[model samples]
Target: MGFVPSQDADKIADTVEPLAERLSEVLGVDIQAQVLVDYTGLVEG
Candidate 1:
């Protein structure tokens, strides 16, 4: 999957990164994910 950058820098790596890692480990796949900033940014992407 692919996406364009959002408006705000609300990545929240501390939370999102670990969750993605755990999910990937449990599911046995390289899960690519992203933390969106807001509704508009999410919709546009």
Candidate 2:
């Protein structure tokens, strides 16, 4: 998947909601994310 824009004219929650579950399976971890949030210095475990 790709980055989803922070704001959209249509409600986007439904569009991005499934990514977390799919990514979690692919990444072998509990994956969670949001658009355009400041993740300045976060690191992955």
Candidate 3:
């Protein structure tokens, strides 16, 4: 995923972590996951 500012990365992580945890608990397994936010501009010439 991509975001305009770097701060958005933290925000996204905060939102997704709990859900990931809940999913892990429900499935009774350790689910390895990661949320990566690229703070880069996409330009075309």
Candidate 4:
């Protein structure tokens, strides 16, 4: 798996890297996941 930053800053990049690392180790495989910042309304558009 690989890691990438969508934009420039600590907030976005800082979020997913550790999660991917830990997930990779815990799953005992090359694990990859995307972190989506869901600021949109959950109930409706």
RMSD of each: 4.9, 5.2, 6.7, 7.1
Question: Over 4 Å off in model 2, which ranges?
Answer: 1-10, 35-45
Q: Model 1 scores what on Cα lDDT?
A: 0.61
Please give the CA lDDT of all the candidate structures: 0.61, 0.55, 0.57, 0.56
Tens digits of lDDT, candidate 4, 7-36: 653565567668878988898988665434
Clashes of each: 0, 0, 0, 0
lDDT: worst 10-residue window of model 4:
36-45
Q: How should the candidates be ordered by TM-score, best one leading?
A: 3, 1, 2, 4
Task: Estimate the lDDT of model 4.
Answer: 0.56
Can you give the TM-score per candidate against the true fold?
Answer: 0.52, 0.44, 0.56, 0.42
Over 1-45, each residue of candidate 1 has an lDDT whose tens digit, in order, gives 123344434445444667778889999999766655556666776
Deviation from truth (RMSD, Å), model 4: 7.1
Local distance difference test, candidate 2: 0.55
> In candidate 3, which residue ranges exceed 4 Å CA deviation?
1-7, 38-45
Scanning candidate 3 in windows of ten residues, the lowest lDDT window is 36-45
**Clash pairs, model 1 backbone:** none
Model 3 accuracy (lDDT, Cα): 0.57
Between prediction 3 and prediction 4, which has the larger TM-score? 3
